[model samples]
Target: MHLLRRISTGGIALCAAAVTITACGSENSGGTTSHANGKVVLSIIVPTHTAPPTAPHAISAVRAAATAINAKGGINGKQIEIRTCNENGNPNDAVKCARQAVSDHSVAVVGSYSNSSNQLIAPLVKAGIPLVGFNAITPADYACAVCYTFDAGNTLSFAGMPAALRASGARTVTAVTLDLAAAAANVSAVEQAAKAAGLQTVPPVKVGVTSTDLAPAVQAVIGSKADAAVSVLPTEQTTAFIRAADQAKAPFTFGVVDAQVQSVLSQFRGTQGDHVLAVGAYPPLDATAAYPGLVQYKTELDAQEKTGDKDAATRDSISLRAWLSVHVVAQAAAGITGDITAASLNNGFRTAKDIDLYGIQPKWTPSAKGHVPGFDRVSNARVFFMRINNSKLVPAKPIAGLDLNTGKPF
Candidate 1:
């Protein structure tokens, strides 16, 4: 039997069994096109009610991308229209947004942030709509055949921590995380990766997600004898831990997932903020010359801000990822010679050999079989490192591409 299956749909062949003609409906099926309006509609779903104060910035980035694309003669000459939905940081609401995308005949759901992939994936796949540039918060984001996530998310960053710490001259590392199943899984993955790199890892110290006091976690880190500490906690917890570490005079080098570093740095200044590593999926947004996508993003965002959008000026990993996602959608649609429908977009994505988001992310090519184990759908495991210096984040190292499944540098 062939390891890969060929699925035929609308006279186009797809390479994987995970994608099907029935699931990715025919383009001429009169599904989501606005016949009267002649507009290609896309949807962006985000969590406005949930975590990450940067959620609003993500939404604003989507709007900015859409506006800029429209000004440049939209996808395939049809002016693009973007529909925004708030997932409310809940599974049921994610389902609602997915259904709305289907009902509205959206070509694709681009660059939305939600952890409720269990509820969102099935509906989107059944509707023949792809979730492009999705945040890989759950297993579904990595395993769902129709879902395409460009960046590796925090898991890859955590997996790469051991090597990063070793490079920083640390022989032993300790992890501080919340007492959640996901947190435990992340710590375990990091431990395995660190061990593969020949670095000793201490057992993870768990704390309550809502606990404001991090003195115990700080003390535990100091007592663990680890030379470095990694935090997989949310923004508030990370900030609390940093402050606690400073107060306790913990001497270990510290790092947090790139997404939370901005929040943590915003609360600190000068040398106090220095030395805190922020590991992430993409390069620092400050390196605009290296990543032209950042320049485009800032330009569009500045335009939106001039129009009085409060969140437009907010540039962070969340917003940058969202901006990259929309650009990918436009790039795919622009390559298609025919109508830019859901099926065509899926085909374009599957057949795409090189998807470079103007240096915002590494080159990506989707696969029928996953490039990494567990995250069978993810295509790349490249990580970028940044260090907080004087209240600003600066690049610490060039991008490191890794085979996360093997915990080896790619």
Candidate 2:
């Protein structure tokens, strides 16, 4: 398969589009450039009004992080000012967001998500602004010099799915993906990963985009007689399939489900979701008390919620990634001797060997050598394999993370 061959040569881009995230956008807007009273300008570009409508959570996470930092003297006395733009999943809009970040003199773009990230990287690179903690949706994100991704992208999640399922005592696993031409590569990647893990792979069951009734798809999984089922569908379809599977009482374990559907499925206790497994870019949202940073994050979120911020407490892959992204930039800028500008912050990100994210994620080194040949910008390659227990997400493995490219526990 192409994904396996790429693993032998470079890295694979499989499953990059498997997940959809929200980003903010507008027709013509720029970040705040007026830097008075020692303020550090940061911008986040995300998609809003897209499918799943979760970009607002990411925005709230960034705001919560900034609010917390500012309350205790932000980044060595420089106030953090965040500017947000809606990319709306459009390449042209993504470019405009990057241009706005440049024109507004943003030191960095932090914790943003968009499928059109391929269009967002170039202008930021030319302007010497570091792009921090963005959802790695495109090949450009993995290779760009200034792009620092704190969490493993979907590429890593797809590569690691088979091993995660195999650990759950599955002898044979079947994949269920959206019926798109791009999803073919994702299935191939899963096949290769399953082969490496000594797990048998059944032919995938593909669902149409507009299919309303998921009864046929549910029956397909039961008929395959696979020990486990890995779903690579969108939020709505995944939700529908889970409901159908629950109604059917399918015997196979749900080895993988969309992380975006966690919030939706958390309410269904003792159902199919109880055994639903998830591969997340960050730690499971339900394990808030496990990390000290997350405890602080939740406290700030509560404070924001009291002030009428609706999505303040929203916890998902995108929200956690965005929250950590802002802190990564803040920690890097904390030690800057002189003025903090785009050039200084970019240089700081490049030179800073190990950036501390307060245990929300592993320490990231932007200057570290790339483990995979084509994915030079992958600062951290750890992804958590989690399961839902009593509607709460907990670790599937004894270890916290797996090497995303290899599916080996780290």
Candidate 3:
């Protein structure tokens, strides 16, 4: 498949009729400036008003990374400027953010969190803009040729759950997921991964996205007589499921995506969270002994917090992902010697070597050759496991590797 489709400047002008395209009239607008002391702007699109309230943390991380990058003489001697647009958990707003990025002449959209990937990708792909460090919340984000996702998001966690659960002494697993399309995809991925791991899985119980009661799902899991259960719901819904499971005295261990485990810890007391596993793209922030990246992240976060940044102090999976995204953008941009345009930045990314997260995540080289089927442009297939202990997440041993195209461990 031909991934890169370059549109003529006139085509971009004509395409403006399809949507409400923001005009790029100013120097810091949609087109990159040729000024000697010009700044390279990077746009970050995140949801701040919607259900999953983690966008602020991600936004703060982007700003913090930009601050750090600028302090070190910036990328390729040009200062990095970060512009943000809140998607507000709406598809139309996501499109608007994409238009804003294009209008701003952003080198790339880095470390953004949005569920409306389909709406976001069209404008970006048309403008030859690359999206990096975004969560794979939808099929388009995974399949878009112009997008380079670092992590497989929930899919990575689901794929690694079976092995993590087996290591935790779980033999049979039951899956609980939302009735949304994305959740269904996660369930299928998990099922395949479970089979590959030599683990047995029962039929998954689907819950409504807006459902407040999770007793039925918990009852189904308890009745399944499984040794472990996996939940592919939002953070709030996952918390409800866990609480119901705890109240019913479910025997099976519980597992969720890394992002869901952050605030839900306080909901489970004592041994409630003991056997709960959280599979993530990066290691725990406290895992300083093994991953020096966590140490650097913490230091920067702490500094941001001390300077009155609200999002910096509250570290979560989304924030960490955003931080990594900014690093990836900076690392790629630092290697460019010529003009840093959208195409040039993407070329730098495609050729980047040793793209490591300081042992927090496995080294990955983002290239078309590394692309996996079904996972679209995602090249990174490594996941770290963590178990919740007394309301705290502790790192599990041995990061699991998977061939995302096959949904099996490599």
Candidate 4:
């Protein structure tokens, strides 16, 4: 009955995905690549096994990428070795991870997740290392010159929410956002986008990160009489709010989940998860489109999972971002005629244009124009929209006002 249902998640599984590889050669901590045991080395810094366990499976994602590459003769005949660092969600630890990347002489830091991008980007930037496809979280990340983001991060997601809701036939929207300053900023962005989309907005119902009882918040959404409501919340709070909304049967559609929450949308089942939209940098793992990247990722990740690596079994947005990041580096490295060292990789990424990821994401350029004011380094401003149906996420049509390239809605 809706454009949302026009596509189904079922698609033909592709045999193999193509990848780019480079002849890596030896070299330094100061913008050069150093290998251990004659292997091309890259590192991923993630907060795994932390207090809140942020992207614990990201390490496996990197590992799986390496495995897939190695299976095909290992990035131009030399096996790729991935070194992982657990930042533990601490700023100091994040800095340590960056410093470690510098000391270990990693060619690039790919697909890292950190709340401390301000701290993490410093050492890598000084060492002339590029951050590829990292989870763009903070203002520092969006503004970092050396950080290459496939996703425009939370701000763009918020900016795109209004158009997505409006496209879903919603004229009035209410916000359910966390009380933190970042969430408030996102809500503000949503308000602006809503105005541009000609959608009416209600003052957000703010919930604390620690707020467990979301029934009252759902009541507030019900009182707003909005046709749709969006959230800017952490994973735990999002789950709680959705559950509360489902229990109370709120009259508005809920949606616009971030990568972190969208990764695990399957955890929400039946009516509780239906009709919600999600925005992400990459296509969903069960994307309706027959993306070669998705097939390759599933194949590689499943291989790792078969080996009894429990972490590999945990496929979320963090890991998928990591997987895509490594592939980006590898694909870029393939074009290098000389040494595939840190300097070469960094230079390649900086000068890259129209790099395609086989339908996994939008074609990205490191130096794309029309940058958003605060998020100057967000090269790929396009956001993919997905909807939950039958307790799963599937690709949905591009909603009006959602494309950042359509105009600077952010």
Candidate 5:
């Protein structure tokens, strides 16, 4: 598949459509400027209105986290301001936001809603601003000259979901993909894993990113008659797919990857999902005590919203990873005594060997081989596979005596 994606600081233009994120940042908009406060203001950008209520709440959680970080003397004692825009979950919008983010001369930016983040690398570099956000870049896309992305390296997604399936003792599997980047990676990786596990393969099926009608895909999955079924589509689409799959009553079990699992369960919470199971890559944020940073974030979110009863907390990897992205810039910026220009940020990456995210995620920096940087150590890969258990998520353990490297069941 070939696509001509125009990426710049103005915005990400997908095909002929031009999209721009809602200019809701808390920083000054400019190309180049001098700062006297010694304060490095960072803009936080993301698609806010892409998926209905969920996207907004997710965006708010990230903003809240940034606000919390700022209150606590922010990175290098610099006060952080968050400028945001609605990507509308559109790639064009993503590119546009990134262009504005880079050209506006803000101290880096955080943004994404899956592939939306991938749409802006070209423009981000053109604007000469550092873009530190979460986007599960393809192992190959990392080679792009324009991509200086700082991934959080919380590995395991559809990447690990297939392993979970093999561990479950399923011998045959059929999977569906949205035919998008991340989803395709999951499907391909899972298929490879299945073959490695000596499982049967069913021809792949595809879906569009914006597809809400999954009846055809559901029927296809149910008719495949494999022992296991998996879908690596976005959360909302996964819901539609799951609902249809459940209705199809396929004998094989159904599974999902990452937060889409949460979204699936949350979407169909309290309903019989035909005993469907969802797998996620990260350690469940809500399963444990809120990351000590979460409380501060909550307080800041409350202050921003001007409400007292702020009950919702940020328990997803996106916001946490975003918060870490800012810290990364701060940490890297601390090393330089000069102005925090995009060039300086890039220079910091070039010079800094490995930037530790203080365990927030993993440390990353630009290397000669790969353009973008982040923790790549196998041990640093802290993705603990988990599955939805009893309507909630639980850690999934590898089979006993399994070859850790091969990930084979004993």
Candidate 6:
């Protein structure tokens, strides 16, 4: 059976995904329609380490996507300059990066993980720097209009995860991940959604990024009378946890929420892979599915003899999330008439709508009340739901209710 997913590729992977241009990307036919405007510089920062060891892949994807935008004449001839800052999982570094990016006059910033990333960048975001994040989202209100933090393509990914658990027919959910406000927030969302669906959201277990034991967490879930357990631990720690759970023959199942689960922490696969699942966003075009616009990216790379064309189309969370971020920033830059500023891009997502770049998800049109214009609170949204299958991401449910166009939740 074919399962849909997304993956992150190195810079080379971006070129490899191009087969031919279609959709908005077709501007490549003649050449990128460069807007006649002054150059704009933007800084994109990502976590140095995390679960699934996805930072490398995510960075590669971002760099490649930037290259694609640049090839298309880059936002009315305004080239986007990407700057990278390694957090090294240290808040001090994160804060330093945030300071440099904000102080540099870049229009936007990307990649903030955990609460520390969010905290590190909060001041910058409040200073009018729009951010697109992959991991920093939590059960709380993280970022706002001046800073649109889109995780797994939308914040709804958090809500939709619990929705998926309900769909799984599971009765109890035991969640574990790194403890912080974000973890609490994630657990709260999942727990509420599960409870509302008549399923129990049990007490969550907290594991540190440096942790290697799962026995305590396992016992906690069992003690909670949970039938299944969910962890938001980093990839390496999660692997150790899963092995411990497996050895103990724990009574409950285990799964994770973030997109980082795909690469190295694919817990449920092969004969021993059952009872593990992860929530996914977009279809992994590289695996199997109809990813129409990417044909050009693929074809482009074929002519160049790139062997890793499929890399760009990786079905990982970081791939789609990072792709959305680049397109959002690129689209924001598209409107520059002359000069570039971080506030300009911040307002771009604020006033932009119907931005269906490559049909990445759905056009995330924000209105004055939120991120962009021409968007209803509910309409113009592309929310996703997916999980691990045979140790790979598979799109199972997508709760994008934006077609209503009313902007009101049903």
Backbone clash numbers for all candidates listed: 2, 10, 4, 1, 19, 42
lDDT values, one for every candidate? 0.70, 0.72, 0.70, 0.69, 0.52, 0.52
Q: Judging by TM-score, tell me the better candidate of 1 and 6.
A: 1
Please write out the lDDT profile of model 4 over residues 1-410, one tens digit for every residue. Answer: 12222110000000000111121111124455757567778889988874664776888888888888888887667788888898988989999998898778687888888877777787787777878877865555655556777765654555555556766778887778887876655676566556556778889989977899999999988888888887767777778888888888777888764564655566788888665777755556776256677877888899988888888887766788888887788777777775677788866776788787767667877777634544555656655667776766676655522345544221
List CA RMSD, all candidates: 7.3, 5.0, 8.6, 8.3, 8.9, 10.8
Worst 10 residues of 5 by lDDT: 1-10
Q: How close is candidate 4 to the true structure, as a TM-score?
A: 0.85
Report the lDDT tens digits of candidate 1 across residue range 124-211. Answer: 8877787888876554455555677777775555555655566567788878889988565567655655565666888888899789
Q: What C-alpha lDDT does candidate 5 achieve relative to the native structure?
A: 0.52
TM-score of every model versus the real structure: 0.85, 0.87, 0.83, 0.85, 0.70, 0.69
Task: Write one digit per residue (lDDT tens) for candidate 2, span 280-380.
Answer: 66776657677677777777778878889887766677777788888888888776777787767766776787788777777888777645445556757
Please, what are the lDDT tens digits per residue for candidate 3 over residues 1-410? 01101111111112222223232221222234323348888899998774665478888888888888789988888888888999988899999999999888888888888767678777887777878888765445555655776765754445556666766677787778888775565676566556555668898888987999998988888888888888767788888888787778778888787787786666678867765778776666776887788888887778778889887877877888888888888887778787888878777877887787666666767874433434445566555678776677787644333333343442
lDDT for position 306 in model 6: 50
Model 6 TM-score, 2 decimals: 0.69
Can you give the lDDT of residue 41 in candidate 5? 54
Q: Against the true structure, whose lDDT is highest? A: 2
Ranking by TM-score: 2, 1, 4, 3, 5, 6
lDDT of 3 at 191: 65
Better of 3 and 5 by lDDT: 3
Per-residue lDDT over 237-319 for candidate 5, one digit per residue giving the tens place of the 0 to 100 score: 77787677666665666666555655445555444354455543345554435235444444555664664323234346565
TM-score of 2: 0.87
Model 3 spans > 4 angstroms off? 1-37, 178-189, 206-211, 371-373, 397-410
Candidate 6, residues 155-261: lDDT per residue as tens digits? 44433444445445567887787777756655664555455445666678887656677677777777888887766666667777776776677767665654545
Off by over 4 Å in 6: 1-38, 49-54, 111-114, 133-136, 139-142, 149-155, 176-190, 201-225, 244-253, 265-269, 285-288, 291-315, 368-383, 397-410
Residue 272 in candidate 6 has what lDDT? 44
